[model samples]
Target: MTPNDPIDKGDLLNVIKWAIIGIVAIAIVLAAMAGFGQLNVNNVITLLTILAIALPIYYFVMMLRSSKVTKVERSRVKAYIPLFFAAAIFWGIEESGSVVLALFAEQRTVLHIGSWHFAAANFQSLNPLFIMILTPVFVWLWEHWKKQPSAPGKFSAGLVFAGLSYMWMALPGMLFGTSGRVSPFWLVGSWFIVEIAEMLISPIGLSITTKLAPNAFRSQMMSMWFMADATGQAINAQIVKFYSTDTEVQYFLAIGLVSVVFGIIMFILVKKINTLMEGIH
Candidate 1:
């Protein structure tokens, strides 16, 4: 491949830098949480503040090193903005699904297999653990698969996987009912499934955004990519009210079905979307 044919070396470096930043930041945050043996408002607040400051500085440095883009490239970027927009909502749903699990997981109050009692944010912390275990598995599968999926196909499948994760919870809710404590494995399974969806969405979403992005707005497009996360979560805040013990099954089914349907739609339209993308995948 030529220097700019597959991907520009500089942009690839920027992606590598941010990917490292994210991984290292998650590791540090999880390490800090582990040191305290749990999460609390104080540590979370502090870490989040540090992250907010640190991420922008990193982005700023990269932006300073970036060159300007062309007019044709700018026009191409505008058309691709919708890709990021859709990704954001799907990302939001994925996030909101975790919050739902955390809400119910805390309610159980005890895990008989261990001495540990349920704590606020305790279930939420399992995300990093699962990510560690499952990431390489996902990477191997994606890399070794007979055929590769386009960006739209992967993104759409991610949404469906997220929906499937919610549906995974609905099974226990339907079978065991929500009256009292059930099993920890239910939450475990849901987290595992969703993180698979993350493997599909998060990194790929970043890559697609940059590849499809206009030259002038390369870095800006990356920034906009995260907006999908915020947008999905914000929507989550509003709709999450619908999730509770009594409504748990319904909520899971609703989100799950919606995600699956959209995934199908995107799959059907993947060819059209790919055409619009020109060469980005």
Candidate 2:
């Protein structure tokens, strides 16, 4: 495509729609299989094992039939190594911090105070309700901010927002006295604050990946983006398993602190990375 050519936005939308449909269809089929007792845990494991073995062989065969990469492209790929590491570390810290916090809250003595279970279930609706209420206000604010010449720097702002969200959770613990029963509002508020950070950073991160990766390696680059998420989840699970104890709250607090620290570091690196990305794009 020529530099001045307009992007086919409709075609992009159609591709996205089909991808979502395919994912949903696969999910439905998997659910049906499990429901029918044809897809037990063992069956799932076997399927995964077969796929894992087959994918590399398939890819290698495709490569053999295709032209080899030149040294210049190889160096270009190597240049992304630091970006990948930074992305992975950032994701790992953020997710692991969340796992720690959730575990901490879980370790809290179940308060039978004032219909706690019912309140907790109702609290699940709190976020959606807040979104429904605040969305218009948020949109207006976003538009106003967009018009400003000095709108906040995206990555730095996102990290600051994340830190603020963690602080929201921490504040309730301090205010209510950790041993005493606290309001569910604290958790809900914290979630809402963090969701804002998510809305900001997630899309920007994806945009950065697409802009930076070479055309030939774009798919692999996207896969690595998601792999960072998977890696974070795996690490979270392992950390939770090892740290399971009455000290879950302490673990969570520690994780939150680490997240804040790493987020600050990420914010510091944003300018350098953004400069690198400008050349790549």
- Indicate which candidate wins on TM-score: 1
Expressed as tens digits, the lDDT of each residue in 11-38 for candidate 1 is: 7998899799989978887888888786
- Positional deviation of residue 45's Cα in model 1 after best superposition, in angstroms: 18
The Cα local distance difference test for each model comes to: 0.71, 0.53
Cα deviation of 47, candidate 2, in Å? 18
- Off-target runs (Cα >4 Å) in candidate 2 are 1-153, 174-177, 242-249, 279-281
Give the runs in model 1 whose Cα sits over 4 Å from its true position. 1-82, 108-110, 114-120
Total clashing pairs in model 2 = 0
Pull out the clashing pairs in model 1.
Answer: 88-228, 92-232
